[model samples]
Target: MHVESALRTQPRAAEGERVETAERVDAVERAGLARSVEHTMAATSTVLQDFLDGRVRAAAARSDVAARLWADLADGVGGKLMRPRLAVAAYLGIRGGHGDDDSAAIAPVAAAIEVLHTAMLVHDDLLDHDEVRRGRPNVAGATRARLVGRGLKERTLADQVQAAGLLAGDLAIASAFALVASAPADPAALLRVVRLLAEGIETTVVGELLDVTGALSSPRDVDALAVAELKTAAYSGSMPLVVGAVLAGADDAQVARLGAVGSALGVAFQLADDDLGVFGDPAVTGKSVLSDLREGKRTELLRRAYAMADDAGCALLDAHVGRADLDEEGAAAVRRVLVASGALDAVRELTRATGLRARELAVDGVPEPLGGYLVGVVDDLVGRGH
Candidate 1:
């Protein structure tokens, strides 16, 4: 998916008041993830939007369209804090109880999750060569028009787009750090959280590099499990929970357990994402189906299928995997190959097993109420969008 899709924040709450709040975490699950996190994220979104709006208005006054673009950009990047909620859930798991004060404390950390997500999207879009995002044009997409308007050639546009996207990724990272720094956690703890954020970024980058390298290499040397765990799983599942737990003053053992939960959940979530990348509803997912196929992602499915494919099948796949123009028919053919080879089932079984592990880990050392809530959340995340 493109940066726009990745950065599309949750919708804003209604104006002139704080959004109506949901009482319990179960209430959130019942309401559906987008809505649950929409309400949870609404308050913080309002603040971020208002700030961006004011900035945009100021820029418009000065006739600086770039400023307006920047502000508008921020508005679009605000969204659901699914990963960060993992963090909050982890915190609650360790804290063993809840109240008004506890809820208030968790909010900022949750918001920080969104911040980090935004950073990842900005970078992912650049890497993917996507010009659009979240059903709208991205910074690069928007710039295309301006570039054409300025009489730039298509080749020049390509160069500038890539460069600008790289810069945008850097800016997104800066913004994520600012958000985490601005939260109400203890100074020392916040510093550690920030460090963790950096570490997650590094891990994700390494995964991305490996993924790209595998795509281009003759032998496709990377391990599918390693790629899935690092690129998609750890950050989205484990890091957020661990960070939240750390923020809530979880002891080392509790924090470690939360990390374990996150690791397993992250793997399951990534596997589900892989499945959805092939099989999801276009409307709900807000993207074309089989996007990963078109992108030639070196997912577990691809790796497993490749290994099992006969020489003829491997030769057929080698020609197909990285083709940007792979169409619906091509993707379907690939699905057929995966299914016939049993690779898809293998990946699915892996997802189910890992999800079970996550649930077990999530509850192992926590207080009852929060642990139960976390286990539910882990379950929700594991098969999400499937």
Candidate 2:
């Protein structure tokens, strides 16, 4: 699902010349995306830092609550601000406005996205029973740490930690809604954005439930890929882009186009991510080796592999898939079976098709500078490891 592989089956400019031309095009797109993300991150960081600082200071008298929220915001905001920044960048691209006030207006909204994302992480960790995140303790892990520090007994500690993490996640979700409502934009647009964000979250939650339920049930008829699109793609990709378009005063057509692009790209991104999760280098992905395999979570790739497998292949997978006791060699063997079953190639083809649709959906009446920049953003996201 890497960028190169994602476009493998698509029409090319020409076999020999296409490589040279594509390389140049890809390089420019990558640079533009990097620049845009860099600028957006700078602005987002300032807003997030300021917001957290204010929150901490306001809660100064309430040390316990303030400290918990502060830790959540600080840790959550520091990671890539890609989602909210996408909204702001899209706004700027469409409106061609960059005044100080305009820039300031986006911070809270962007910060809201971070808040929402962190809340989702808190929930996701709870669902997956993950022990680590962003190379550190997640909300659940952090709560457990606090409980241990308090010298709570084992069962008491576990219950308290779980409860605290769940509540913290709920607070983060609430804060995100509050931040969006507080954005200094057109009141109507702010309300619309808030509503859309809530709907997107709900949609994603439904998809997540389906995914977890499917994993525990029979594998047949499970469209895990579609679930990935609905859950991860809808919120992570579409919502941010749509929010940006709304902020920019984009017409209905433009906003809809951005959403379509977001949806397609989001799916591609998630598929690639799933691939990397199991097969990627730990050094590069910043997670434990074969974490996804060890976790026994069902991904589109896994479902497809299982479906496409021969009798012997199915036997091999049945013996290994979702076995927490699997060793390193066992995981590698499963991967080999997946590749041999041609599931990887099929999924890769779907990724390419979706990416092309995304490119088509992305083309709209946006200003040239902004449009080019946005396209670059799409390219970099679908093409790179990050």
TM-score of each: 0.82, 0.86
What is the lDDT for 202 in model 2? 92
Worst 10 residues of 2 by lDDT: 363-372
Q: Residue by residue across 1-386, what tens digits does model 1's lDDT show?
A: 68666455323433212344423543554334334333444555554555456556765787675574565356457545578666656665555434445555556666656756766776678788877788777767766656777878779989877766666666657666766776766899889988998899999988888877887754345586788788877788778878878887988987788788778877888888778888778777675665677787777778888878777677777767667888878877777778878888888898889888887875577655556666777777666776
Q: What is the C-alpha RMSD of each candidate to the true structure, in Å?
A: 12.9, 8.0
Leading candidate by TM-score: 2
Q: Which residue pairs of candidate 1 clash?
A: 4-133, 4-134, 5-133, 5-134, 9-78, 9-79, 10-79
Counted clashes in each candidate structure: 7, 0
User: How high is the CA lDDT of each candidate model?
Assistant: 0.70, 0.75
Give the Cα error of residue 295 in candidate 2, in Å.
2.2
Residue-wise C-alpha lDDT for candidate 2, range 33-97, written one tens digit per residue = 44665566577777767776777676676786667756754565457666886777777766666
Index of the highest-lDDT prediction: 2
